[model samples]
Target: MSNQTSVTEFLLLGVTDIQELNPILFVIFFTIYFVNITGNGAILMIVILASRLSFCGPNHVHHFFCDIKPLLDLACGNTELNLWLLNTVTGTIALTPFFLTFLSYFYIITYLFLKTHSCTMLHKALSTCASHFMVVILLYVPVLFTYIRPASGSSLDQDRIIAIMYSVVTPALNPLIYTLRNKEVRNALNRKVRRWL
Candidate 1:
């Protein structure tokens, strides 16, 4: 009797069912990849560039991949340590954004009620922060749901749906949310387009 168990790495079967759909899938995903990278990268860049961009504090992140916890699944051997690290890292990544968003709105409300006492400014701030916060929550909650909890014998469909939610849907919605909600940004874009034309 052998007391050996085989461990295999999980392979991502990303929508390869219909052979005829390969090219279409490739085009679609390629566009999504571009949008996700560019959109997130641009937001990060803007945050870095703007001195006024405020957060609670500086935190050092120690994950190989920029996006967060999925790299832990790629560990070759015993994944205990990797899983622990991923949980800690992913938990912070998931919770901090939500907390900050809440705090931002809290301050905006406080500021509205306390200082200046103007409903218009408060409404604008609330509208702006709410839109951004909604997008952030939508992006992070699915990731936390998929990764943070203990892994169980679940079908790949669940994981695929989550991945699509965070990656494709979130990215697609980000530009629209930011553009539609922020009047300043919308006006700036219009001005830029007029200048270009």
Candidate 2:
């Protein structure tokens, strides 16, 4: 709690007060934990393996968590190195996709107005990229807000909400957005479900 004395580890007081609801909370969070790991892992795996996948260029992430910013705060030792590394790495990850998505749309719009463009292609690309952009914004904005600024004081509640937003909400939204906006993904999902049945 002082500049002279360094804290070794910070306690994550994550929803532990609700004694009766702990079981339910555990189940909910455990489910979300699995989903977050699997969903992001799946995306990373597909992106890594698919030679033709042409979104952003290749970058292997170095964070223990799905998003790296929060982990920086939890480090109680000398965080200067961790902070620098996290800022450089996660900042690039967060912003690069946003810029690429923006440029993609910029070209799409230019083509629509000035070149031989089909409304169908424009709509499809916009819808797909917009959904991705939305997810990226939702995931990264809070992280940037929480991590980029110097730590004033540690609030467990604030950290918990931000963690939930990035880990749980973002993962849940990915599949939902793709399923709802993408006809191909939806059809593929349906076919897979039917085959399983």
TM-score: which candidate is best? 1
For each candidate, the alpha-carbon lDDT, in order, equals: 0.64, 0.62
Q: Candidate 1's residue-wise lDDT over 73-170, tens digit each?
A: 33334545545555555576567667887787788777777885677887877787788788877887887787677755433456667777887889
C-alpha RMSD by candidate, in order = 23.0, 23.2
TM-score of each: 0.48, 0.44
Q: Where is model 1 more than 4 Å wrong at Cα?
A: 1-81, 153-155, 182-197
* Clash pairs, model 1 backbone: none
Per-residue lDDT tens digits for candidate 2, residues 94-191, read: 67666787787788767766764787876876676688778777777777765655555645566667767777888888778767776788889889
Tally clashing residue pairs in candidate 2.
0
lDDT measured at residue 190 in model 2 versus the true structure, 0 to 100: 89
